[model samples]
Target: MKKRPVKAAMIGLGWWGRKMVAVAKGAADDLEVVSAVEPYGDTAAAFCKENDIRFFSDYSAALADLEVEAVILATPHDLHEEQIDLAVKAGKHIFCEKPLALTREGAVRAVKACESHGLVLGMGHERRFEPPVAQMLAAAADGSLGRILQIEANFSHDKFLSLDPSNWRLNASHAPAAGMTATGIHLTDLAVKLLGPARDVRVVCENLASSFPQGDTLSAHVRFKDGGTAYVSATLVTPFVSRFAVFGTKGWIDIRDKAHVESPDGWVVTKTSTGMPIEVSHVPPAEPVRDNLVAFARAVRGETEYPIKGSEMVENIALLEAIIASAQNGQVVTVA
Candidate 1:
């Protein structure tokens, strides 16, 4: 018997939207994008015509289609809440980009809407699907790393000041906080995923570059529920660097760059107190976009569980709120 492919629609055909379209096309056997909604008529019309798919200037038209089982949102950070709510009401599964929503309340409402409607909501924390990260987490769970003691995560780039100020990312009205919320939030979310919900968070923001109206850099200190602490540093004013290291009571793991670790095959595992090295072969996963898209397709088909949960997004947003509050108040804020 022949099986039907999952019909999908994509809202927003901007930079990220194009990349998502490519991924969905690559997974065409399992999923197909039948409709795309973009406000830019020329771009949306051209893309839809080239791909032989339906195109609309408004998302409501796409959402009204009965064949569209899922909708991928690649719009700006501020629009996620309303779009998710509309999709949920229309009974469509949702795949949303990172951070989920601008505020904690918005994220909570999105989660609640999806839950009430019995729809699967997937967030774009794609790094969790990376093979090296997956292995490190598994080893930690198996007691290879013993009790985790500390974590250090860093993600920084020089693009903030270099990019045009007209970009929505530079506008705090659209994104709220600065570099940490835009970039470091991923590291913060990843840390929480590896560890647990952060118990407390303290943050500081500084205007290291004059390009932004507000601060262009942010640093945060976090304490997790298990007594483990983490430091996240991010900036748009500095050179590029991305890394994450975890120290446990028995040993540690380090992930450098995006794919490479520090030990053999770019992964390093060591005994905590003794400083003795442990042997492990680590291979990076395929590109995260492909991995996450495929995972979402499988989840839609009930073949696997969604890698990122809606409740976890609620926590991530809550922690982000606390970080911003701590930065603004110059005091540590406890996660509620």
Candidate 2:
């Protein structure tokens, strides 16, 4: 028997939200975006009309709709906690975007709300679903990368350079530590997964050209509780550069992405060992964004558990808070 697709309402109509809706169209068997909520309704209403989905100018209206089995929040950074609470109260599952909350306390509260409601809370860390990244994660988990010592990652792009100066993404209050919330958070998530919980973080932020008050370039150094370390960097002025590498006692692995996640070309996975010959493998472009949504849908349908744990969700935001604090104080900050 074919199961019905999970009915969903996309709560934001920004660049990424529209992109997600476009991708979800290809996964009709697993999910369906039945409605959208955009306070600035003119442009978004047109988009919703073009996609043949209902539109609402108010979030409460969408929450009141009985057809919405789940709510996909691609809203602003600061609005996530309150929005998640509303969704849980409405008895809807949630698939929230990355940096779930700006503060550790907010992340904890959001996670707890969903857990108490017996609702599935899906996160938006799609990089984990990328084939090459999955391989790298497996290598780190298995004995291939013996005693993971350090992990380094760089996820930078100039995609936001063209945004208006008044855009929330460019605003310091919404997106602190330059590209940390936009891109560096993903790197930190991967690092945490590979190296366990982070103990502390130190960050350096600088504004070379961009209008962002915090900076255009951000570099973060993190030490994990288990003795591993990570160096992560995110730049708003650079061309798309997505790379992740893990170093350990036995070997090292590197994954080089050819293009951005939205429109991927491919990836190159390189492995090097002390004595063994270096090996390189090519991975074709995949729809990890779509994969993440489908996985969330399956979890909503009681098929399987979501890949992101509640604990990790809280930890990532905690690390993000630490990064921002370190950037402000010019000193190491503990990840609480």
Candidate 3:
């Protein structure tokens, strides 16, 4: 007997919202987007009409539907806490976009609410589903790279230079923290997933370009609980580059991009002890969105664990709070 697909409602019709729709369509066997809520009436209507999905301007209308078992939030960062609370209260599972909340307290509250309700809460740290990143995490856990000593992850994009100042991403009130929250959160979350928790964090933020009212670049130095150290650099001052380097006592792994770790030419892995280089050849996994949505749907169906947990999201938010505090105080802040 075939089980029915989990029905999902996506909130928000921005860039990420459209991408989520595409992913849900590709994985329609396991999940189906029954409806969507978008404040922008015209855009939402057009999208729904084209995709043959129901659309509503009010979130309550969408949430009122008993057929929708899960909600995918693609709204602005500032709205996550309140919306998640509402979804949890409504007994709907949730898949929220990253940097779960702007503040530590908000994140904790959301997690507590979901836990109290016994609902599945998943965060969108989709980079973890990428082939190279997944492989690296597995190897690190298996001690393929002995005692990871240091990690450096960087993400940079110059899109802000051309973006409209009125966009939500450029507004500090909406984004809270600038470069780090907007782009670097992915790397920070990845570091935490691979190296456990970060203990002491020192951050520096600079307003390199005045295109947006907020700072354009942020650099964070973090020490892990396992005595490992990492640096996360995020900036809108350069062309787009997404790279991560993990160093350990025995070897190191370098990932050029999250999506193409397994190119036809293969990835390069080098051993520090033997000084031998090996080309790792494996097919890249499916698109991260597909994997992320599938994982969330499976969790909803009781077929698997959620790819990311609410507790992990809270921890990441705590780290972000520490980073922001350090940037503001101009000193190192200790993580709790």
- Candidate 3 lDDT at 45 equals 91
Total backbone collisions, model 2: 0
> In TM-score terms, which candidate is top?
2
- My TM-score estimates for the predictions, one after another, are 0.89, 0.98, 0.92
Model 3 CA RMSD to the hidden true structure, in angstroms: 2.7
Candidate 2's displacement at residue 278, Å, is 0.9
Query: lDDT winner among the candidates?
Result: 2
Give the Cα-based TM-score of candidate 2 against the true structure. Answer: 0.98
**lDDT per prediction?**
0.77, 0.91, 0.80
lDDT: worst 10-residue window of model 3? 258-267
lDDT of candidate 3 over 1-336, digit per residue (tens): 887888999999887788888778888878899999998747779889899999989888878999999899999888898899889878998888887987779989988888888787878887788777787888898998888888898888776787777788888777644577777888888888777878989988878676555577788999988788889988877877777888888788877653321122323333343377655544444577777888888887889888676667777888888987887756999986
Candidate 3: give the clashing pairs: none
Please give the lDDT score at residue 64 for candidate 2: 96
Expressed as tens digits, the lDDT of each residue in 57-151 for candidate 1 is 99999889999999999888888988998899899999998778766798899989887887888877766766667767787788887888888
For model 1, what is the alpha-carbon lDDT of residue 43? 70
Ranking by lDDT: 2, 3, 1
